[model samples]
Target chain A: MAFAVHRPESMEAVIAALDGTASVAVSGGTLAIRAINEGKSFPLAIVSLRRAGLAGIAQDDGMIEIGAATPIAELVRPDLAFLDGVIASFGAPAVRNMATLGGNLFAPQPYGDFGVALLALDASLAIAGPSGKRRLPLSKFYETGLASNEIVTGIRFAPPAPGTWRWLKATRRALNSAAVIAVAAIIETDRSGTISAVRIALGGVDSHPVRSPVAEAGLLGQVLDSASATKAGEAAATFHPCFTDTYASAWYRRRVLPVFMRRALLGTPLETMP
Target chain B: MKSSYVSFTLNGEEKELLIEPGRRLVDVLREQCGATGTKNGCGQGSCGACTVHIDGVAMLSCLLPAELVDGSEIVTIEGVVRNRVLHVLQEAFLAQAATQCGFCTAGMIMAAKALLDCDPSPSRQAVIEALSGNVCRCTGYEPIIAAVLAAAATLAKRPAAAAAA
Candidate 1:
């Protein structure tokens, strides 16, 4: 149960430390520490990402680049105001200070709202492993999982135009609770208020953050409204085979998905919607 | 596994120890340094009882590896007192009757202290967000939230009074 922790200070050092060894990389240590205490099947060696030169935010051209190890607290800045509500909806201030964007991608379902947001943003991840460095779409990373020694180095995404990104995390409690149904979408409406392009991503409904192609397909050319939002939500829920746990049940999630989808698009509460 | 020498500033004092690799910061603070002011309600990070400040940010000490914090400055509940006087947040907690069972008081005070240190005037919603990770089984969160807001008001007027005896 005891493992030696290795703190590598540079990208090269971190990449070299992952030499096909049985080690787990820890950033923030919020999730890993819990796993360790619970006596679950975990790695014998921990490579601390604390000193791994993977913390900061920068913008190049239209792309916003975030270091994988940057704490969630750092991301809640005024410049990135769209994410303020989402990040604030996560764990309390203490947990946010200790949780990292990279760790959220690896956190289990119902726990990674940031991942859902990134998927909605069409973010790309820069990964390093034994072979070399490669960039892949965030969704691809979800499907392929990680190579044995690979570590997610950073994420890059072109910022969506204003009024395009929408996120809502439905939690039983306003804070510290897992998502009942977390939804994020990037939708562009024409001057006539018809949907031009739409990408919808969801959390807490699947094993990993996922895109709701069915929902996107349902709303592409329609004028977004309560009715269209309801239909799109239904399409998305049909694709989500929700699982029941202590937080909520599958039936409860299915009942609320339509309401949340309407809220995400129409910006109206379920009760207010016609 | 070999024990490693971990060094960090604890409650403004430099500390070094040959500690087990899996040792958590909360255990080290309570067991080794006898700083029991930081209670452990739930060994998991869900309960804010093990909250502390690392490099000036409030974090769950239970989830931090003692080795990872080497050379970092840490502040626990014990560090909130200065010059034999309670921190303003603590004073406000007492004034607002925020303690019932007292198990979660230390962590709540530490969490509120961290919030006030960063934002002198946190809104009601902000206070709720800051202390959301901490759970109080008794005397629900309204009093605690009120206490934090009051402390912010007092600290804003006499900023240095918190450390004065």
Candidate 2:
């Protein structure tokens, strides 16, 4: 049997409550309901983030800070409006509205939209526990996201100097959980239109979001040509596969990782375009 | 349970009521507030039938708690009309033949209205992205999209008239 709900005003009060026996923290409540229905686990108390008034995106000290309760629906609506493609990639607007960034970041399951973009952006995890507020690299937070006691408060990241961001996610049913793979790539080009800096992050093929150092190294300073892009794609297959659930096989995940990497890093070595 | 006082705006009216935190928004809208306009097609957030405008954005009422919106404004299907006259969106949906079974019509209109209000000259892709969350079993969606685009164009051309009405 579940207990009553709790909505705290400050981060301190929320942390104090977490020190109590135990309860489920919910922002949009989309994943909590999904977990209950999927028979994974049931939470006793639901701490809704609504009244906490933690919303919106702010640029602080050159870092992008997104509130814990910022729903995916709103995040998709960038002020510039050129990100409509990236935003549209998430499940129809309903899921986006009800699902949130913090919740998606902390969900134990691998089928999350931010898994790629946040990683590509090199985002950090903001935590508010009894120990007070602390920030962790996004990679470290993924290890603890499965823990019941840890609550992700927000994500912070400094924008890449100047680069192109490409996100590739494969959904079997179009609007369903990605079965095979997802990749987020950010690369900077020189005045000559040659590659200067590059970073690659892959998900759905690892227990945690993994940075493809091999892929990144292969693309850096290489003009990111097609032939070099192929090599970068091949290097991505080196990471371990996140083989859980019926999404896809570990082998299949390995094969698709390269394909996604190659496609995600277009306009390079292929010489097809200058 | 009785001490849970929720104060929020419903259909432009400030409201305060005693309810529990676990009480879902759909239950609150249909049972306590007597606003049956927000339908619950799926208790989960997948279906858009339970959609409502919370702070001028479409949200799945089923996934939210009534207590969560204690200070927020909620716009339901019934709230879209003016003195029994249909909203321009309603007329457009009708003029373009946008409904068949009608399960998704209300939510679709509300979502589209929010998009148009913010960006009156939304592209065809924008209209589709805005309404992608809504599902119409009756394949009458083509006309629905056309109507919203047409209505957006009309409203853009005559913003003063549309607002004055």
Candidate 3:
């Protein structure tokens, strides 16, 4: 089937293009185009964000704002070194060049590892629709996906404190493989090294990435160590359901969830882990 | 659906073509432009056999719509050669026997070329990381990694030769 591609230059035009038609936004084309090549049914139209004025990174008042269409490759700058490991855990360099931050937020499980990290960081999304622009928390946006006429304009989040951010993705291959189980966490501690605040997000364990509130609650008032991490891991894995895919089995993922959660919380080196 | 016109620089040459709706860049390059060097292995983003440079950044051509390259600079395996001379990376690949079946050679070279263009002397780990997307089932990847490292070393010693290529 022939489908029209609309390369709109502005956010207003993009929303207008999606106002009524069954159109999908194309950012980097990593996901949308792949679906097309796989012989899946194409949308009525494609709204290309390549030329839209929505690709950039800006820092203001300790918050980092990244345009929704910005390539994942651009996130590897030295100034954003804290995200180095998280971004690297994504696809290889070529794929990274074509994947966008906003697209990752919508990617299915075992693929949206970056989105999991953002969830742990409490990131918010800037969405623009026909009505106007609106701010929504990333977690909430995941629950209620984009309206037909809305497009994600940008993502904003404050930088995590040094030595507090941790991310890990367990893959069958060291590179280019989908995650067997992915974990991202932000653990803040008091001056005495007692846990103050914590947010943990897990991917490859559900249909979408989910926060481990039980894990976070268990870690509070406790020191971050192997024992506490183990407890937190157990708490997080208690009743969660994991799905199986070509990369791993549901049984295997359930068995490894707690182990990976502990490893992620303890900041264990990937090379040293199973 | 109506056909659309796309104009872009292909390997230093300006070309324009009327592409059908929903056509991808890889198909256009191989069929319309006669640049068959960019192989369409999987026709999906999973395989890097269709890797090409758009605006000096490496990307999978199969995933890029023809309209997206309307005003961009594109470089394929056919463009890697300058004045009938193979690029240093090509030479190193030949010297190191990086190609067995040779199907993935073009994409591998293109991906490696972009890595070297950005970093003149990339470490072994970085070379492996850069070429990770381009899969080589026949050679087992060690020789390809060696060729890239060797090319980086050669490029480091002779800056003039590297620049000329």
Candidate 4:
């Protein structure tokens, strides 16, 4: 049986096409294409986002606006150095060329490094749905899930201050491996070196990426150092329960979450304790 | 649903064909186009044996959808050879024994071609990063990496050779 493909040229066309029976939106197609090929159930029509006028990077007034359908490979600009590093470690070169940022947000757990990074960046998403257009913080979007007829149009975030954003992914290999423990954060200190603000996100340890509220609370108003980072890391582990899988055991992930958390915040090596 | 017509440039020549929706690019290249040079190491996107150049970027043909190829330029392993002569990277692989079972050579050459086309002189880490999508069971990666570097040097000195590639 042949599947119908709808190539829409604008956001309105995409939103209208999505209203068709059993139609779904497809951007980049790295995951959706594979899922269809693997004999998973097919939608009657696919609304391709490639032609939907949603593939560019722009910055205005310190806010970076990225078209949701923009390929991860195109995000290697000098201003996005940390994102470049994250993309390099996200997948192979071929994968990077095809995977889209919007698709990454909806990707299954353990496969969305970009999602984790965006969550920590406190990014907001502009989504177009059957009702109308609306904005949602990445955290709320993840919590509430997307409506079947909604399509993410863009992601907006301000670049974090220099040296304020820290990220680390402990993987099975140096490149393109699934994370054993992935962490990203924006941590700030006051003039006296006390932790003033923190936003931490974790991946690979749960069914979905999550912000570590316990860690943030633990680190607030405390001195930013190895000891405090270790304490916050331990608290972060309590925020989520790990599960056993092919990549790692639940016990192992739980035991190492603190180590990765510390390393993400304090720049400590994985094997060494603070 | 009906099969859609896809017209794209293949190896510098415009080719038109009708393919069913959801048909993978690798299948069309191998079955319909008779371009078996692009092998399918893993039908999933894991192995790079089916790598091809889509719009001057290296991508896994196995992961590409047939409906997405309209108006794009695609080059498989068959396109890598010019004027009945092997490309520099192919010659380097031959001299360095970069192939073991030879299942991955076409994809490796295509990937190397994409990398060199963009950055003629890539560092060792860059070469490794470029080929990270491809996996080979034989010859280890040392010879393949070395072969890519050697081909880069060959292209550096001979501008015509680089132009032909």
Candidate 5:
């Protein structure tokens, strides 16, 4: 089917363009155009966010707000060095120049590695629609997606403390390959080195990114070590059902999730983990 | 579907075309603009054979709609040469035998060109990361990496050579 592309200049214009029509918003086009080329049926119109005034990053009072249309490559700056590992583990440099954080939130399994990291960072989303503007936590947005005519405007989150955020992705190749099992965690400890808070997000094992409460619970009040990481990994493995895809079999993913979870927590290199 | 008129600067020349709905930039460059050097390999974003520069950043042409690039500056492999002379990257590739079937050479060179444009002296690891999206079916990646490093060296010696090309 043929579809006209709309390059609206403002959020209000974009929402109006999407109002009461069979239209979808596209940023970067990495996923949307790929679907179009694969003969996937789409709406009659595509709202392109390229010209929209929705791409930027702003920081205030220890909080960061990234416009929904900002390219993923923008996250690779020196100020945002904490995300270096996540961005590196993502698609290649060219792909990063086009893929956006907002679009990453909608990517399917094995493709939304960035979303998994955001979930661990406890990010929230700003959404605008016909009704008005509203805010939703990233975790809840995963369950109840946007309503008709609603669009994500931006993402807000606070940077995790230094040395607290950890990310790891096991892929067939070192770059440009989908993850076999991607893991992200934010583990904060007190002066005594006991885990005070934890948030764990896993990708590529399910249809969408998911948080592991069981795993988080296992690490609370415990020291971060190989044994605790193993316990947390064991706890996380049972919470979600693994999905098989071209990257790996269901059995293989399930068998390796615990290992990856442990490695992510302990900062173990993939080559030396085994 | 209604067709839209889109205009852009292609390889330093202003180009305007009537584009149909759902038309990709790669198709426009090859069919309408007569710049067939940009190959369409996977049509999906997986293969980087359709790599091109929009506003000086490397992007996959197959994934970009023509309408989105209106009023933008686009550079393809055909634009990399100057006055019948090859760019330093092209010369390095030739000297290193970096191409086999040559299907992926244009995209690979375009990607490398973007890298060199930003980082004049990129390490071998940086070259690999830049071209990770591109796939060379002949598996001639070692020579390609070597050529990019070599080109970087040549450009470093004669920085004006890159600007001239």
Candidate 6:
């Protein structure tokens, strides 16, 4: 048996117990529990956020608020219909069923697909720790490793009205593939279908999920033409590449950056897809 | 470590047991609860052999702490049947010849049941998405897909029947 302690119930209890001693905060356990069972350790006490009511989605004032414990599987349910493509790109059905938005943030892997999507949208994380509530940029949560002391309660974001989102993950196979580089972008197209504002976020390419401001700046106000798409792709790939257990080397990622960039900028929507 | 007390509803029955905190839901079901229909394979979370429905959602029993189930409702393969008759899904599985080796049959049934319970009428894409996490080495997937589709058709017809009645 794995050595552990578990509480199914509350987030406050989970947070209170997280003294960074024996207890660890868990959300769905897709990444934390797996790592702990495999002998990875940041804490001995395992406080589950399963019963924390963190598994809900609601939109208020144009901001989509996802409960920390909300499973990625639940993200596609009509409430989160706008980000359908983003959630489906997380992993296999099982992984998505277990992986939570909180866990993905807590997981701290640079290749985390969910992280890529959220960063592009400028998501804000709601965290609870010994000191109490703190709201920060979603990217600020990582600090070289998992923050056992802090428990992430949820994330909130206000997406652009009538916008376009595109998500692409580079992988060798369907399930459990290491993300070489996962990309997510939101763009507003003008009446003539030219680009107005473009935001691009990339993961598995850096130590943390980051927005390519340079890419966004370069593409903003630019006509949404094939040449402009090519320029955005090149700008997005300007960051040095990183690798994990998945497909594509640094060179390969750089080579494929333009393909995803083009699709993210100019791709058409499919009536039915995964 | 010594065991503690836990109380949860398993397949419509409220039960309590004294178990080790380290014990997973699969261990509690198979050993403490004496429901061997919940098999244990790859005690890790990767394999679907220990899959179960907690609060109507499919999760890995092996990774779930036994104590977390306290107050939650659970369903197992043994409970898949209804009124002394096999569930439509089980019947469809047999009719479509979906099981081979049979080790993974129970977990697959549980996984499929969770999907059907939520959405009786599902698209082929939805069915495929639900079972993509389940792995079966013996029987090719075409048959299982057939079984799920058959079950979906059967399940989809019931609401109309109820409405008409």
Most lDDT-accurate candidate: 5
Residue-level lDDT tens digits of model 6 in A1-274: 4445666467677777667567667777767666655667555567778776777888888788888888888787765676787666566566677778877875455447777888877898887777777787776655343355677777898864655776777666554455666778888888987778777888766677778786788788888867787787787677545554436666777777776677666664443322
Task: Show where candidate 4 strays beyond 4 Å.
Answer: A268-274
In terms of docking quality, how is candidate 2 classified?
acceptable
Candidate with more favorable, higher TM-score: 2 or 3: 3
What does DockQ give for each predicted structure? 0.77, 0.39, 0.79, 0.64, 0.80, 0.44
Task: Give lDDT tens digits, candidate 1, residues B86-131.
Answer: 8888888999999998999989988888877778889998899888
Estimate, for each residue in A1-274, the C-alpha lDDT of model 2 and write its tens digit.
2356778886666666555665777788787755544456555666767656677788878888888888876775444243344456776676777788887775543656576678778888777776566788887666555344556778888765543877766556555344367778788888886788777887777766677788888888787666777788777776454575677777777777776677767723334423
Candidate 6: C-alpha lDDT: 0.74
Could you list the chain B TM-scores for each candidate? Answer: 0.94, 0.91, 0.98, 0.96, 0.97, 0.91
Alpha-carbon lDDT, every model: 0.86, 0.73, 0.89, 0.87, 0.90, 0.74
Model 5: per-residue lDDT, tens digit, B1-165? 899999999999998899999799999999998899999999888879999999999999998889999999999999999888999999999999999999899999999999999898999999999999999989569999999999999998996896775
Give the least accurate 10-residue stretch of model 1 chain A, judged by summed lDDT.
A265-274
Candidate 5 ranges with C-alpha deviation above 4 Å = A269-272
Give, for candidate 4 chain A, the lowest lDDT window spanning 10 residues: A265-274
Residues forming the 10-long window of minimal summed lDDT in candidate 1 chain B: B156-165
Q: What is the interface RMSD of each candidate, in Å?
A: 1.3, 3.0, 1.2, 1.7, 1.2, 2.7
Q: What's the C-alpha lDDT at position B40 in model 5? A: 92
Question: How much lDDT does candidate 3 score?
Answer: 0.89
Using all chains and alpha carbons, the TM-scores for the candidates as numbered come to: 0.96, 0.85, 0.97, 0.96, 0.98, 0.88
Q: Any residue pairs clashing in model 5, and if so which?
A: none
Clash number by candidate, in order: 0, 10, 0, 0, 0, 3
Rank ordering of all candidates by lDDT, starting from the highest: 5, 3, 4, 1, 6, 2
For model 1, the DockQ equals: 0.77
* Residue A11 displacement (Å), model 3: 0.2
